[model samples]
Structure formats: structure tokens, C-alpha cells
Target: MRDFTVPAEAGLRDAGLGAGTTIALPSGRIAYAERGAGPPVVFVHGLLVNANLWRNVVPTVADAGFRCIAPDWPLGAHQVPMPAEADLTPYGVADLIAEFLDELDLTDVTVVANDTGGALTQILMANHPQRLGRVVLTPCDAFEAFFPEPYTPLPKLVRLPGASWLASRLLRLPVVRRRPWAFGWLAKHGIPGEILDSYLSPIHDSREIRRDARRFIAGVDKKYTLGAAESLTGFRKPVLLVRAADDRIFPAQLFERLSAILPDARLITVADCWSFVPEDQPGELARLIVDFATDRRADVVEEEHGC
Candidate 1:
């Protein structure tokens, strides 16, 4: 696997997530950025993006006395590729997340997830809920909407030979990358060129990364999400379901269904954003996370003290 230093231009420094660290998991080496020293909060990003998705939100949460860990999951845009024998399926990736938390010995973790990451998080919550204290799910795939509408063809498309290569090449063009089918619908105000480059360059530059992407994409199935949704009622831990008020992809009914199913769930809708809530409303998202995490901790403390 290639060793990568956090680029100075990735805006990680500005986000207070300085330097990247590597962790050895059963799958392979994973690269992550972290900061702060309090309750642990892990950030999981979606396809074709890395930890940089949380760049604008990390600093504030870290400052709020929470340890923020953002890993560049092997989702095409990650700098490090998984081993050739690694399992990149939705179930496998969810296990990889459980492994990461176990390796770090992090308990009561507050998991904040976006996009495809949210689907993986749901799987993790279903299969491995021992370490998770609570969860924050922004607009993402759920129920039968795994990959959603315009994106439904992605799994099949990536299965075609050379499709991954063609996609990486096509995304290099500014016009193509900004199309609604591309990164355009995710954010409202548009991602910065530098940040977008950070997300796109890995797949374009590395054959192994493209291979990893293809494996993961080809393994996408809505059944995994449906299965997770079926088990959500058993996830008694607190959950914050965040809906983007103007999200064009994930509908409001998804969050409504989640709130109804999760035993201790609450739903909040944020205005003026699309699917990528972190990119469009980082400040508001961060505040909501910090409050949810800290407030839950306080409630636990009160119960422990018999107050």
C-alpha cells in the first residue's frame, strides 16, 4: 500500500484535523485524521469522497471537547487502498468499521455519518452496536433507496469492465463532474475546487483505488439496507435523524420512517442544503452533533447518580 501524507492544500489544517494516521485492520491499512480529547466521535463519509467531507465540521466539534476521528474509508477517493483480498461489500465494509472501533478500544462512540456512509453506519448499528453510544445520520441511503434514483445504475455500471476507469477519466472534466448526476446534487453552493480535487484525485490516479471502488460498488444491494431497517427497532440507543430540507435525493419520508422505527430516535430538518449536509451547513451540523452527544452523556451521568 502507498503511504500518503496529508496534503497541505486539502484544508485539513484549517479544519484542525492535522496530519493523517494509519491503522492496521483485518482488511488492510486505513488512513484517518483526528483531533481533540474527550468523548469520541467518528465521522464516516460516502463514495468518491474521503474524510475531507467533514473538514468544515471537525474543528468546531473538536473544540467542543470531543475527539473527532475521520477515516478515509476505501470508497474510491481514499488515499490508501485495501488489500487485494479485502472484502469491499456493504456487509464487509460495515464489519471493517466495527473492527476499527474495536481496534481503537473506543467505547460509547458517537458515530456521525453522511451519504453512503450512512447506509454503512446503519449496517454497523445493526450488526455491531456494542461500542456505539449514539448516532447522527444525515441525508443518505436507507430502506429500498440504497443508491437512490439517478444513482441506482451505479452498481451495475461499475460491474462493466473498464467502467471504473472511464468514470475516473470522465470525472476529471469540470463540466462532467458538476453535472447533477455527479457531485452537483450533493451540495447546494458547490464544493471548492481544491476540496473536490482531493475527493476525485485518488480514483483518477490509482488503479488499485478504482479496483476497490468497483468491488464496493458492484457489491451494493438494497437488501443490506432493508435488513438493517428491519433491525433498527432493536437499536435502542439514541439516534438523531437529520434531513436536508431541500434535499433532492433522499426524501423526507425516509427520515420520518426512521424516526418511527428507532426506539429512541428524533428527527430534525435543516434548511438550505442538499444531500451533503456537512458541506452546506457544517456549523449547524456540528452544533447539533455536539449537543446530541454531550446532552446524552449528561443524561447518562444523571441516571448514574440517581438524579
Candidate 2:
């Protein structure tokens, strides 16, 4: 985005994809890429992560006879603005996504979302119904988190005065430095480095990244809690919960609450992965998607694709 000149084909760089597609909305911008030539499968990543988080699973989904559209929203968890006091609210972010979806007129689209993506996808389910076909939420953060875990430091620090500078410094620590490593390892479940680069390509430093993270945490109450929270009532979308068994960010209870509330929802625990399920269990995730979309026709997944 240094040039903001979109990398051609409307950001749809991949062949047979809408490489540089920019779906303009009222809020800010929606940078997206689409691939393959089958049904549309929309992807949304969590807070700081971009739509590129879906990079690992896109090809497999496309290979399974589905098109992929991954969109990057503004002010992500890693977007660090210089001022450092950006008011990033979940309702605001959710509003941005809802507007993006409505503007794009992408109806009957299947969704695969991780982290913040999972939360906003739920927002989409609550607000827009016709546009949804199937939803796969992985390693979600739709409810209250970032309170009692290691990441709690994130919210507390982000809100402090001039927090961006400190966040930038702290993220370079050995512990924080390993995030990219962990991120790479997760994506190793399916994608190659080139694709993984897209996932990590969003930031060059912490200052540029910290602002987004702060906003993501601060916005949660507004986005999902106050606004989108009440909207979750009587939701009937077909949801597949691809959970990370060991995810501390969003625990099992959250998934259980979702499974209990969602009229049609199933959960699958992905072992050996954190909150990043697409990267943790692509093959299994893909298989479940195929099964879920095809009405639990597990054999169809193996037979139709032989993947």
C-alpha cells in the first residue's frame, strides 16, 4: 500500500483471479483478490492479519471447485498510526466489513474466517442473510478475550499513552519475534512461502503495526459485544467450527456457546495448532468444508477431489 496503486488486476495478482480488485466502501477501502473458476468462497482474517491469512487454503478450496475472494480491511490489529490514539472499535470494524459485503453484492458466498474475521463474519450473518451460503469459523475471537492470557498485555499496553512506540519495541522481543515463525509453521500445513509472505507482508515495523492491534482490542466491545452481540439471536446459518484445540486466545467454551446458539453448527478441533486453523489443519479444514457444504457427504470430499 506504499504506492496505493494496486498491484494490477485490481489486486488480483494471481492468474485466473481478480488480482487488484478494490471494492470501495463508505468507510475506507477493501482490497481484495479472487481466484479460480468455481463457486465463490470469501475469506476474512483476524485483527492484525490481512486477508492473506487465507492464502494457504485458497488454492485447495479452488482446487475443490470453488472460487476464492480474500479481502483486506483497514486499520488491522497491526496497523500502527503515528498519532497512536486511533479509536479502533469492533463495531466500527464490523460496520466497515458489513458495508464492504453489501457494496460488493456478493450473495450466496461461502465464508472462511479466522480471528477477527470470525467475529465479523458472524456480524455478516446477523446483519446480512441472503449473501451467506456456508460459514467456517476457525480459531475465533468473537467474544471477550485478551483479558487473562499472555496477550492481555496487548490491550493494557495499547491503551496507554504513546503506547504505539512501546508496542513497536516490545514486539521485537524474542517472544514476539517468534510470532512470524509460528505463523510460518502454521501455514506450513498447506501453503508455500510465497503465499505465506502475503500473510506477513502487511507490516514492516511495530509502529506501523501497533495501532491496528490496539484498535482491534478496543473495538471489540463496540463491534461484537454491544452491537453484534444481541444480533446473534436465532441465527440459522450453517456454520462449521474449525477450532484449534490448544488455542488460548479463544477457548473451547466460546465454541461451545456458538454451537449451542447457532441453529446449524458443528465443531472440529484441530490439534497441534494455535488460533490459526487454516494454517494448522488445511487438509482437515478443507475436508470439513467440503463435507459441511455437501451436507456431511464425507465420501464426496475424498471421491470428488481425491485430495
Candidate 3:
């Protein structure tokens, strides 16, 4: 049990994040950002991103009296590389999430996820829902849409040697990253240059980080989520699906399907946002999550518009 704390004023100035911390996990050192204190809320992000994705949302929820923990999972953008023998499969990632919660001894936690993180959360709920209190899923890969259609090229690209590494290098180019097929369509507004740099640098600079990215990409497919869906019915915890209304990648109809699939789940549509709701509508997203966590959903969740 170790804590690597970074001064809030200096460490995360670029991302406007909170105190950065890293804990030793069985697979490797997992980095995270935490703030405030109360009930625990863990955030999970997808591949090629890190805890910084929650920079805007964390403070709002943390200030609302919840201890927010956003870990930089080994999904490509993480600074720390996993052990050579680490399992990087989708189910393995879910196990890591469970282990992370157990390591911190956080029970009855609210788990929030976006993009690929949501897919991993589904597996966690299916296999390791004991420590989870509730779940909030934003727009993400669902059913058989693993990387979604436009981006399905990723899995195949990663199969070819050195392809993923080369693609990562191209992401360093601002113009390539913001192209519609890239991150351009994911958020209504572009992420700040510095923050984007932080998200891409790990894979661009380190072969080990790129290896982690390739391992994750190679494992992407709908079968993992399909299997998780079979067991989601047993997860009776409160569930909220906050789908981005304008997301071009993840279909809006999936949210409608998920509402019917989970016994305790409801759907909320966030307008003027794309797949990256945390960056596009952080305040509204945080308000919805806070309301859900506090069991005060009449106003926040009900105000949702049709997708």
C-alpha cells in the first residue's frame, strides 16, 4: 500500500486536475486522482485516455461531498506500463477494476464510466458487483459494437505488427487528432492542446505503453460485452445510462436497449454533447451523477431530454 501524491497546485495544472496519486497493484502501479471526501465514486475511462478525462467532472462531484477516484487504467494512455505477464483482456481489465476497489477497501462505491470504460464496467457488474453501489454509463461501446463501426478498423490495425505504434505517432499531430473520424466527433468542443498532449504522450514516447495499447486493442470485440450482458440481470444496483445525444460513434438506440435489459436501469439523454460527455457537458453530467449517488434523482435525472 503506497501513495504517490502530487501537489494539486503544481502537478496537474495543465489538465486542471486534482492531487495525482499512484497505488501499487498486483499487475503494476495504477495512477489516479482523488479529491474531497465522503462516499466513494470511482471513474473509469476507455483506451488512449487517462484519469484526466474526469478533470472537469471530478471537482464538481468531489465538492458535492463525494470522494472521487479516477484511475488511469492501462488502456493505452496510462503512464505506467503493466507487467509483461499482465492480462490485458477485457475481462482482465474488469478484474483489475475490482482489484482496485478491493485494494482501496472501498465498498458500496458508485462506478462511473465512459467509452470503453463503460464496456469494462458491464463486465465488472456481471462478475464483481459486490463492492459496487451503483453504476452510471455514458455513451460507449455496446452489444457487438466494440470499437463501434467507424473505428472498427482499430482491432484489425492492431493485429498488424507496428501498425498501432505508427497510428499513435500520428495522433501527436494536432490536425490528425481533431479530424472527425478521430476525436473531432467525440466532443462538441476540442480538448485543450496541453491536455490532449498528456493523453497521447505515453503511447507516443514509450514502446511499453504502446504495447499495452496494442494488447488492449487486439482484445477489443463485442463478445466480451455480449457475455457480460448475459449476467447484468443479476446486478440489481441502481443504474443510469447518460447517453450523448449527438455522438456519431455510439448509437443512441443502444441506451434505449440497455434501459430494457437491466432491471434497475433508466436512460437519460444529454443534449449538445457527443461521446465525451465529461468534456462536453461536465457540469450537467456531474449534476446527474451527484443526484443519482445521493438518491435525489427527481430533478436532475428527470430533466433529461429525448435522444
Q: Which candidate number maximizes TM-score?
A: 1
Sliding window of 10 residues with minimal summed lDDT for model 2:
77-86
lDDT tens per residue, model 1, 130-225: 999999999999999998988999999998889999999999899998888899889998899888888888899899999999999999999999
Candidate 2 residue runs with Cα over 4 Å from true position = 1-5, 8-18, 75-88, 146-148, 173-175, 179-213, 226-229, 296-307
RMSD (Cα, Å) for all candidates, in order, is 2.2, 6.2, 4.9
Ranking by TM-score: 1, 3, 2
Tens digits of per-residue lDDT for model 2, 134-199 = 788887665565232445465556678976565445544445545642332233344454443443
Clashing pairs in 3: none
Residues forming the 10-long window of minimal summed lDDT in candidate 3:
7-16
TM-score: the better of candidates 1 and 2: 1
The lDDT of each candidate is 0.91, 0.61, 0.86
Judging by lDDT, tell me the better candidate of 1 and 2: 1
Supply every candidate's count of residue pairs whose N, Cα or C atoms clash at under 3 angstroms: 0, 22, 0
Candidate 1 Cα misplacement greater than 4 A, ranges: 1-15
- TM-scores of the candidates in the order shown: 0.96, 0.75, 0.93
